[model samples]
Structures are given as structure tokens and as C-alpha cells.
Target: MLEHWSSSEVDPSIRLDYWRDVAHNWVDVQPLSPGDALEASWSLLRGENCFFGTKRSTAYEMRTSPRHVPPGEDMVVISLLEAGEMRLNAAPGEHQHATAGMLGLYAPRQEACYHWGEGARQTYVALPRSVVLAALGREPGNLLLTPQRCALAPALAAQLAHLGLLARQPGRVSAVEYAGLLDATRALALLTLRNLGRQGEAADLPDLEENLHAGRHAAALRFMEQHAHRQGLDAAVIARGAGCSRTRLYEAFAAQGQTVMGALRELRLQRARAFVEHSPRLHVGALSWRCGFADPSDFSKLFRARFGLSPTEWHRRVWMEPALRRGA
Candidate 1:
């Protein structure tokens, strides 16, 4: 489920107060520049394995105290800034600056202060520290995962952005798919951290490139699965969503002996088959439209070619199996 909060719904005079109250569990929000005229929105999907979300706000400052955090919560926040600028300071003379496309790993248990410019937009995910430890065999330190620091950081950032997209369309994700995403995210993050820790001294760089492509492939699959219901969904959109170029996306799919449109058609057919199996009385035309087919006849033709029977025949077969066996 996605939870959303915005200062727009509150009275102008009390918007800041409301945001501060609403966000008290994590940090104390303050209007830093363009004072008191607060405009910010936060949306989060708190999954069983991880929390993924996005935040959009005007210029603001956030301070976290030790008391604000739970006594023993062991989790890390990974943020990818999409727009504007940010300054994060966790201790004296320990300041990190970020701009668009920069990824940062943050320790929530530590007291910290964050300041960002107007129109700041970011996507983030929070996962248990154990996930990192299990993959990296050590606790992750707070630092920016930039291209200069880690070659795999861009791919990991792309995965985080993909999670943000999936969070926006929660209905498209199943428990199994969500678990798959969590696993991919954990793997990518840990690989990035491992690479970052090595500081460009790794003896085996091919492994990192392989994992980057794998991460991109998994991200593209999730994006396609979520947007398959749209008739216009194609390779370009898939490439953008997966944070790779059209050539790279094609190469990834081709490496597995798959085509982008073929995979999309398969996804649509699978969904249509599920509906036909369950909704016995639903109309074929409506089902076809729901599954992104522009023409019912075309849908039927493809369905028959794939399943060796038309949807109606498949439906009949599904419902008649038990009765036919009983008669036998």
C-alpha cells in the first residue's frame, strides 16, 4: 500500500506545523528558505522487506535527533536525488553535497541534519542492516555512491528508481514479485557497496559488469510487467524505465533469447488467461481490452496460437475438467 501526505491539504498558516507533526517519527522538518510557505509531499510504500518511496518539497531543512530514532533500529536509507541540491552533515566537518543523480547511503540511527534547495525531488528505499551485512559481510558506512566512487552506483541507483516506480503502481506487484524486487535490490546495493569499499582496486571487474546488466534486466522486467496493460508500452519506454539505452535493453533481453515485445505479449496473455480462468462470465472483448489488445479477434487468434485453444475454449476446458472426469 502507498501512503501519501501533502501540505497542500492543510491551511497555509498551519502547513508547516502539520508537516512537522506528521514527520515527527523520522525527523523534525523546518522551512529553511522561502520561509513558512510550505509545499511538500511524501509518498511511501512500506513493504514487509523494505520501504520504498519518493519525496518532493520546496527548500527545507530536516534535523534528526537521537530521541527521534528508535533505540535499536538497524536500517539504512539509500537515497537517489533526482533534482535540486542537498547538503548533509552528520558531524562536524563531515559534510556531503549532492546534486541530481547522486546516490547516498545514510545511517538513520546517527544524528544528522539535511538541507535541500527548492524543487528537491528524491527517491529512496530503507532496508534492514542485516540485508547489507548478509551480502557484504560488513556494516555499510554512510557515503555517497557516485560514479567516481563506485562504477556500479549508477545501476544501483537505477534499481532504486525502478522500485519507486513500482511503489507508485502497487497493484501491479504480487507478493512473489515484490520479494523478487527486494532480492534484486539487496543484491545490487550490496554489490555497489562492495565495489565502493574496494575503491577501484578490485581484481575482478567483469563480475561487477555482469551484475550491472542483471540488475538492469530485472528492473526492465518489473517495469514491463507493471505497464504491460498499456497498449503503447514499447522498448523505448521500457529502456527509459529500466535506466538503460534501447540498444542495451535489447542486448539484455536478447542475451536471454527473448524479445521485448514478445515478453510483453506473453505477460498480457498470462493476465488474460488468469481472468478467463476465474471470471467465467466476463466478455471476451472486454477481457481483450483489459489485457491491452486493440482488437478482440487478434487477441483470440494469438491466444489460440499460444494455448492451442481460443479463450472461450480454454474457459470451457477449465470449467468442464472436473465434471468430465466425474462422468468418466
Candidate 2:
């Protein structure tokens, strides 16, 4: 859809070539342009009649009431911008110069024109009136812009890159692959709506919370890995790095149902035990200090409590390389 219309002031043409089974009456084509507007072409993809489009505004000025949508034709239009700025008039307040994010709504059958700053890249999604009413549980006029934070925005960026790549490829993709693309676009729409607080209430699955855990836990693990050598590394600092309260951080681990302190101690002692086992001559006391234990006696005591043997004894038993202990 990035085809440049002309080198001169010619505006890019709107190409809506795919219209076979739209599951609706006429789509009511609207140019959504201003007299001052230059280039404007939108690439279209339809999933079960829902439309996904990307448009670029080669504009460079402000406009007052540049366009409007009449109140009749039923459709919802959404906008996701890769970069650049635009001012949007909607409920709550006007959005100014938003980059790398999304803004969208039910079309509400009225002319709409945006005042954009220079050339801007935008992605659009069009949903049928029935779909919007089903999702919004209200009339088009009542369906205003809502605060939506889609995590899939990053994923959508990736999806766009993949689409661009496929289009650039030498040969036409198989029908199966094309079908997959359509399905993916729909999935992206549903995902975006879910992120934007448009979807029906979910049951609040804990597995869905996996991302939260992954985000926080990965950071915590990386921090612990990097500073495992420090004797002062503890729960509070890890919590700070993970951007979680100490109690919340503790609960995150506890959700996994693992004892945080116990896990930490085991990890340290496990490393110390491995070092001692691998190097037949590595000093036990030195290994203890290296793994962040301030004193070898405390390390040995914990090691015995954990493994039913002191660090040195455990090392001796494992260093013998018995066939049963070879996995160590």
C-alpha cells in the first residue's frame, strides 16, 4: 500500500479492490481527505468482512473541521501510527502528537478529517456496525474512545514488518499462507481490542498472568545473575530492579509457590557445590565466599541443612564421579 501516487501534487488513490463477500451492504467509500491533503492510499485486508488497512498522510498543515462523517452508515475505524503526530478530537480530551501507539473508534456515520503534522504513517482497522455494537454494547454515538494499552502493539509492529516482507517476496504466497495472514490480522485485532479494554470481561486466568511473571521474573533473574557475586544482593534490590514492591515481589515468587530465600540459598549453594565438585583442588572456604556467603561456617551449615552433608563432604562425594552422580 506504500505505492507513491505521483512525484507532483497528485493525491494517492484509495484502492479497495477486495469486495466479494463483505457480509454487508455497500461499504460507503469515504475519501477522508482535505483540499490541502496530498497523497493518500490505504492497503486493505478483509477477515470475515472486517477490514484492516494502512494509510499514509502526506500532509503538512492544520485544518479546522476538515472532514466529517454523517450519522447513518455503521462502521468503526481505528488508527495506529508508526510515527509522526496528529490531533484527534474525542471524549476525555484531544490527543496530540502521539507516536508509536493506537487511537480508534466506531465510525458513527459522520465526516472526519485529522490535522496531521507533515507525512505520517498510520494503520487502520474497520469493523462492521454489528461487530462494534456487539463489542461496545452501545450505539455508534455512545461508543467513544477508551483508554487501551495493547501489549500487542509491539507484536503488531512485528506483524506489519512480516506483511511488508511477504509483499516484497518474489512470488505469490500459497493460498494457505494467505489464509494464515488473514487469520493473523483478525487475531491482532481481537488482541488489540482486548488490550484496549474493549473486550468482554475475562475469567482472569493465572496463566494469562504469565507475561507479568515473565517480565518481572526475567528482570529479577538477570539482576540476580549479574550481581550474584555481591554479598549484599537481596530481595529489596531485586524488587526495585523488577519495578515491584518488596511484598509484591515476594508474592510473585510465592505465586510460583517457591520460597524466595530458600530458592536463593539453594541457587548460591548449588553454584558453590558445583565449583567445588568440578575443581578437585578448589578451596571450600574460598568457594563459599565467592558465592556471596560472608562466612564459610554459615555456608557449610546451610549446605548441610539443605543436602544432609557439609559442602566439603558433598564435593568429595560428587568429585568421585560415581556413575550415579555423573549428571552433576
Candidate 3:
């Protein structure tokens, strides 16, 4: 399960006293000194996972606004302007103003701040330096802003909205579910952020080249899908079949926020799941071997860890599905 924190039911004086530990159990929350920051973070998280910039009756101030986070520290904030005007000032004298239906990224690592207009209700998600680096796949601490016009902006905004609702109504969701949602949202945000960086940034591509690369990647994925059933299919074989070096293959898929090994595991587990879900009578030991595990015990452990159910138990549940029932 993904780990997460909800602001609801938190003590009013959270960071000041006993509530500090409260944040750590579910989320990481540390008030930054003038120059300290978590780094570029995911907007789907709040408090510890990310910082926030919203206004109450009095003006709310964030690390941005005439603040420079220096070289190493960073606090990347995502703001969804529900109903208000906000201005962000960044280095190189870049600034943005909001009117309606807009999403903004404020890089506080390099001298930036958000100015909340009068009576504005803006939701902010601050990500740490580590999260930003993970998403960008590079160290870019300055200002990286992608407005709502981008393809993934809408989805990010929607996720932010969902998270906002959860923060307001934390009781409705179980801690387990909340953790999963946070993980999903964070993963989605990273993927979107990476895509946004590449979109319209590369040289004009030949249609043929684009098609060719797409086909290659697709073929590689297809090959992995088929051979994921074979435990012997390691990175070396995949690289050879994909017609790329191990490093190149890794780089290509890593752009999609997935590693070579992770794809193989996910594909294997997924196919095995399909098999068991279809054949309820399949024994765990046999299914594990068939799914590429040399050891049945290891297979059971992994299956339980991945799907949160033992193979036998999972088969029972899988057969319970109406579609699989027809076969049963």
C-alpha cells in the first residue's frame, strides 16, 4: 500500500506540539527554515508529502515570494485556483497571473512566491526536492511551470480536486485506501510531469520515425508480455530482442516512469493472475512454476505481496467474478 496522510482530525496546532508526531505516522511534515525544503513534490499530497499555499481570513504566506531556496533545497508547489487571482514571481523575472480554471507550478527553489488575491480559495500541493527530481529524471531546481493547456494538466487538476475532497472528508476513506490513492496520484503526477517536459520540446519528428519508434516500443512491450511467463527471460534477453542495449532500453522505458525489471515483474504477475482467475482449479505450486517462478514458495509470497492475496485465496476470489464464473 502507498503511504499517505490526511489533514482531517489533526490538531489545530499541528506542527507546534504533539501533533508533529501525528504527521509523521502517515505523512512527513517538517516546517522549513528560511532555506530548507523537501524539494519538488507531488501535488496529490499535502502537509508532509507536499506543502500548501491557501488563504484563510488573514493572508497565507509560502516559501515563495521574494524567497530564493539556493542551490540544493527546493519546494515545488502546485496550486489549483478554485476562485481567485494568484501571482507567482520567479527568477529570470518570470511571473504568472491566474483568473479561472488554471493549474500552476511554483518553483520556490529559485526565488519565487505566490500572491493570493483577495478572498481567494486556492489549493496548493508542495512536493519536495526528491519527488521533483524523481519526476524530472534530472536536477532542475529553477522554475518549471506547465499550465492547464497541456494534455496532462486536466488530469492533474482532477487529481488535486479529488485529494482536496479527501482532505476535507478523511473519515470516508480507509487509511489503506487513502494510501493507495496517494500512491496512484503521485505516480500519475510523475508520469504527467515527465510527458509535459517532452511534449513539443523535441525536434520535429518524421512521421515514419515516430511510427517506427512507437512500433519498436510496442513490440518490446509485447515481447515482454509473452515472455514474462518465462522466468529465464531477463534484461539481457529483452534488450537483445528489443534491438537496443541494456542502457538504451532502460532509458527508453524509464522515460515512461517504469524500469525494465518492474515491467517484467508486473507483466508476469498480471499474466499469472489471468491464468489463475481463469482456471480456479490451478494449484498454487503449479501456477507459480508456470508463471516463471522456480520456487513455489517464493511465488506464493510475491503473489500475496503484489495482489494482497495468496494464490489459492486469490483463485477463489477470481472465480467469484461473473465473467470467470461462466467458465467455472
Candidate 4:
């Protein structure tokens, strides 16, 4: 299926809202400058296992927020920047830039923020994360594939640009041909990953059955990380978010010697630890509530058990140690 969207078709007052509606299928979008004239258009070609398209847009930011996190769309995006620039902050203190002609890779399942410059044009392919994992024999961490990093990047960029052209005339392509295109693109993508020395040979890659099983766990973990702070988060909610059965969820986590609820608690504690480290002035009771703990005392026990110190003790130690050392 091929679909097109244009900001010109909508009223000027609602163009940003319309763009948000369209882009929300993949990432939640917000304007960088409120009330700026947003101009954008794109055509998308969807096949059985992949989506290919090109988008040209003015300055805006797209993000993945915890509340906006959807259940399961385990996909990786490969973008071939044709013009302008992109800034990505995929994690705290980690920023990357991709200029025109660079190939960018990121997992939509993870939290990220993407910024596009004015008149940014890019041809992109979104494929199931499992497919890319199988192709690379492992997960591809987010990065830009510069011509220097991967000799095949230039060729891959050209192929992606051609995909955008094909998307413009989707009716002329038959289903079988579309499938073939995806297969070929997957092959090229694999080469790019390997060329960057991301993984070993095809023989080292996990078999199809194992990759499918692990993919479920990976998807579930992604969901857990995003929603760990919710008070009612439980096994059933996680299973639903992962798009898997409760039994499957249990099996997936058990394979790593972890339990559903146990994992959730650990995630919460980890989040709490981060809060303690960053905001030592925050009361432990308030921090406990923010991290989904019902009782501040219980939260302190868990925090101490996990980190060898109560939240208050840990916070004081972390913040005061430098001062103490400086005095010494």
C-alpha cells in the first residue's frame, strides 16, 4: 500500500496537528517553534514486512515519550539523508549528527529524540527489528553510517534514494516485485552492517527460531523500560504491551532467570537510584512515590538491598563524598 500526506491540503491553522496525527504512527512529533509555518509532504510504500518512503519537511522535533509509547511496533528505521541535517539525542549525554549523504539507524522501540532541519529530505525504510537482527546476526546499536565507517554506505544510500522514487509510483509495482525489493534491500542492509564490523559472519548469526524467541523478550524489555514508573504496571500489562501471551512473557523472562514482577521492581529501583544521584535534595518519600513504590519504607529496603544503602544514605553519600574528600 502506498499513501501520501501533504501539509498543503490542510488548513494552515491545523497543519502541525495533521502532521502530528500522521507522524504519530511511528513517533510523536512537536514543533520546535510554536506557530511556525510547517510545510511537509511524504509518500509511503508498505509491503508485507517493511515500509519505505521519503519525507521533506521544515524544522520540527519528533520524540518517543513514555506516555506515548505504544504496545509493539518492533521496528528499526534506516534513513538516507538527501538534504539538510539531523540531530539525534538517543540517550542522556549522547548526541549524534547526520548530515546530507549519511545513513542513519535507530530503533523506534527505544526512547529517542530526532530533530530535522528546514527543508530536510530523506528516504527511509522501516523494517521489523527481527529482520535486521537476523541480517546482522545481532542488534545494531544506534549510529550513523558515514562513508568512512562503511564503504558500502554510499551504494546503500543510492539504493534507498531509488526506493523513494519507486514509492512515488507504487501502483506500477506488483506484490511479488515489492517483496523482492524488500529482500534485496535487506541483503544490502546486512552488508552495510557487516561492513561496519558490527558482527561476525552469517554462520555466527542466530537461527530463525532463536531470533524470533529473543525478539519477543527484547520487545517486552523495551516496553518495560518506558513504563516502569506506572503504579499499576504488572505482568498482564507487560504481556499486552509486548503483544505476547502471559505464558510467553513469563517464558521469555524466565529464560534469563528473571521474573515479571521482579524485573519491574528492579527497573523501578534503578530509576530511583538515578533520581537519587541526580536530585539528592528530593525527599526519599516523594522519590519513592514517583518511582511507583507505595511505601517509602519498603522502597528504602529495596533500595538498600539493591545498592547497599538506603535511598537517603545513598543520596547523602553520593553528594557528600566529594565535599568530604575535598576537605580531607
Q: Which candidate comes out best when scored by TM-score?
A: 4
Please give, for residues 1-328, the per-residue lDDT of candidate 2 as tens digits: 2222222333233222221112113223222222222444345555566655555545433222213233443466555665566644311112233555535443535433344544676665567667655654554431222242334455655665456445444256764675578677656765665554443233122365666765665566666666666788789887887798788777666554444555567568767766866786757678877998988888889988755578767766655546455666
- Candidate 3 per-residue lDDT over residues 1-328, each given as its tens digit: 2223333434444432222242212222233111121221112233346443332221222334323344443556666776656545311112355655677655554444544444455555667767876776666443324442246877877886666666555367776676666666666667766766666244223366445545555556877866766778888898888887777677656544456776677666767777886784878777877877878888888878866677777766656655575778
Steric collisions counted per model: 0, 10, 16, 0
lDDT per residue, candidate 4, 1-328, as tens digits? Answer: 5689988889988888787777556678876443456899988767667777798998788886445645666778888988998878622222466778878887776678887877889898877777788765667567777675667878889889887777766587876776777668767876776676653343335677556557667788789888877778888998999999999888876654557787688778868888888884869788988998988999999988866678887777768876787899
Ranking of candidates on lDDT, top first:
4, 1, 3, 2
How does each model score on lDDT? 0.75, 0.53, 0.56, 0.75
Model 3 bad stretches (over 4 Å): 1-57, 60-73, 90-94, 137-149, 200-328
lDDT of 1: 0.75
Writing each residue's lDDT as its tens digit, candidate 1 over 1-328 gives: 5677888888888888877765445677776422247888887766677776787788877886657766545677788998898878622122366888889987766678887778988888777777766654556666777687788888989998887777666577876776677767766776886776677445324476567666777788889777877878889999999999998888776654557777778778878988987875758999999998989999999999866678888877767765687899
Candidate 4 Cα deviation (angstroms), residue 15:
2.6
Q: Go through the candidates in order and give the C-alpha RMSD of each one to the true structure.
A: 20.6, 22.0, 19.2, 16.4
Better of 2 and 3 by TM-score: 3
Give candidate 2 regions above 4 Å deviation.
1-37, 60-73, 90-93, 101-113, 136-154, 164-176, 198-328
